[model samples]
Target: MFLLSFPSLIPLLRAGLDLDCAESWIEEKGRPLRDFLSEYSKAAVEQGKLRESDIDNALRNQYMTLMRLGYFDNIPRYASLNETDICTDEHRSLAHDGARQGIVLLKNDGNLLPLDPEKILAVAVHGPHARAPEKVMDGDYTGPPCRYVTPRQGISKHVKISHRANTTIYLGGINLHIEREGNDREDLLLPKNQTEEILHFAKASQNPIILVILSGGGIDVSFAHKHPKIGAILWAGYPGGEGGNAIADVIFGRYNPGGRLPLTWFKNKYIQQIPMTSMEFRPVPEKGYPGRTYKFYDGPEVLYPFGYGLSYTKFHYETSTDGTSVTLPATGGHCKGLSYKPSVATTPSCQAVDVAGHACTETVSFNISVINGGGRGGAHVVLVYTAPPPEVAQAPIKQVAAFRRVFVPATSTATVPFTLNVCKAFGIVERTAYTVVPSGVSKVLVENGDSSSSVSFPVKIDFSV
Candidate 1:
């Protein structure tokens, strides 16, 4: 069958007649896949599996798909294709803006960040990734970036401008192959040598320690979390070409970080408890499945929670709501929380129903006012979360329903309004059915950096299946 399907192997069939084949078949070249497919189509037609007209139709469809995708004469032709012209000043500015905005300030104890570049005599930058450029790319999928900026380069440039220094110290080397298609890390902690290097620097230097971490996934930085000397932490996820400059800008107060964490950063101890193979979205108490994500995770307090990020400056939030009740569509089933037990797996439960068989809903419209209290102008992301009442079933502890990024000038306020449909916000899914069971009051929280305001509204879930 292989010889018949692969035209290049037809010669092998003739060679097989000799029966004493000793050399490897790796040297054999295969015919073009298109030519092989054409021959295969002819054979299939003779065997009655496909009609002659079917082959023509398939080829025509493929040609049409290619044409639609601009693979033929429709290709674009620009006037200039020079690399420098392609990457314009506007493009560089946008890249810089992206890098600055995406920088998440994980920790800044005692307001140690937004470092005054002029205050220090000398600054020491050391990490396996601080000077390494290879850390930016993921395997062969991405070519070497046009411009590379290591964290060290970024920090040094700004430091040179601010402070004149004769000697700079670089310490410790921690290298690991963490990015690959099928490979996974054995653990989440930093390499032992890396930790030792940090400790060595901490003990030797009298100056403030600013730690910059580069990683695609979360790392357990419990040691740094407790360390008194380490004042700041910047989680710069593989910043692209302008990463170094962006890091420098944020450090020197050129940019204010508004990026929030997309996932939870677990501590070292929690790493072993939550196995990577566990896929349950809800907590499994019996087998010790802690569950995944901030939505269902009922484990130990994480190092950094989802949507948690620090900024150099602080902001305050004021929230007000417009409505009290909403109405929802009904499903024809019992309204209850869905549970997945190994022995007794069943469909999701249903909510209470009205005489008209429509679920009761409430629309909560919020007017959130965010004021940047600090001196620096920066952007703030307003996050809105909804918590279901106790009687409600199959709901997360709290879920983010709405979010917005607003830029508020120093001492100025930005009012961002959002309308949420309570019925849709609190809906849960069973095997194949979706139901909303809001029995009591639900809390709505509007949160900004360091501050949050919440309001409670009574819920009436009345629907008929």
Candidate 2:
């Protein structure tokens, strides 16, 4: 039998009873509101007081509001509304797109990544969540689909994987909701025996093991070093539906992983002195904190640095200019001397350099080149700047004046030209009793990534003032 079926009852309960108590009573009194709306809507329609479409809209709005308030799971209702098609193409696309976007490039020393699937033998896939499905959209705990792709399944498409096999590839990690929501992880270890399993495989296996972490954030895997046999590790976060396929593609050298880390992975939780625990915002001044990331951080070297990613190839960087001194052709446009020993571009004039002279009136060109010696194609970053000693500018340990990314093929090289502007160059911050001013220096530098670490070359220009 229908009871007090009133739309306004929700507001009355909200105002009078605690949310928790109200939810319990509402669940116990469910049919009342539904019955009232159905009957009232029918009467209104019959009397022409309200249109049928209006009633439908009101009901849809009420349902959605309840869904948002954690009062219901409306998936079944939505599923039926869209033409009884149990499975939609959008669900499949979401899975694929999610997986592809979650691939993270952590490290690539000696270009050991994008595994050669053809040469692979037996692979070992181990991890609690490796085959587990993510939590349902409504936060229900559902086991993995029977037809799921674990690391073994995904990689097997390209190469043979083993339970007692040759190479071992471990894919496992905690899900995102664990650390982000359901009360942040108490420890930084890879969840659910994943760390122990990886270590066990690395020790027992004779062939190289690839450890892939399927997570949304970093985890402390100090044990990683103990498993030197684990040749490579890739952080493949909770990739959407296509994640399994993408993981396989990367392993088989089908896709070159070019993604860089958006966060630093520490050795463990203890090492992450300032963990992101508090959701509240705290304002820190610019230049307020130093050595936070790879550069200025006073802590131990991280497992991986931010902006760190690997390719299947290697690049050798050489600059024609020095930190204390830099050179560019007087004519301006592109500089010629900015180059590498063995580069991708043939014509020196294809690139440019710039130089400045006294009274801050100079312009010139700079050229840079790079060579790929690895067996695969990848990209290289060329950074240029005019820098002083760290004590001199109190500037960023290294100031990047200009930069470029040059793509190179295996066993090939390329050259790029950059022009330097005088007004941009000869400015120095002179500190008086209180303020800093733009003064002149006798020299400027053009170098690679770090100014202090790179060799210095003289740029011919007059800066005496």
C-alpha lDDT values of all predictions: 0.64, 0.52
Candidate 2 per-residue C-alpha lDDT over 323-438 given as tens digits, one digit per residue, 9 for 90 to 100: 23333233433222322224333433322222233223355565566666678776555555554333232332333456666667889878777776644653332222221112
Model 2 weakest 10-residue run by lDDT: 17-26
Writing each residue's lDDT as its tens digit, candidate 1 over 286-379 gives 8887777887788888888888777877888765554365444555543444433345333323433332234334566758888788888888
**Model 1 regions more than 4 Å off:** 1-65, 78-85, 135-144, 161-176, 329-363, 421-424, 431-440, 450-465
Worst 10 residues of 1 by lDDT: 17-26
TM-score of every prediction relative to native: 0.75, 0.53
Per TM-score, the best of the predicted structures is: 1
> For candidate 1, what is the lDDT?
0.64
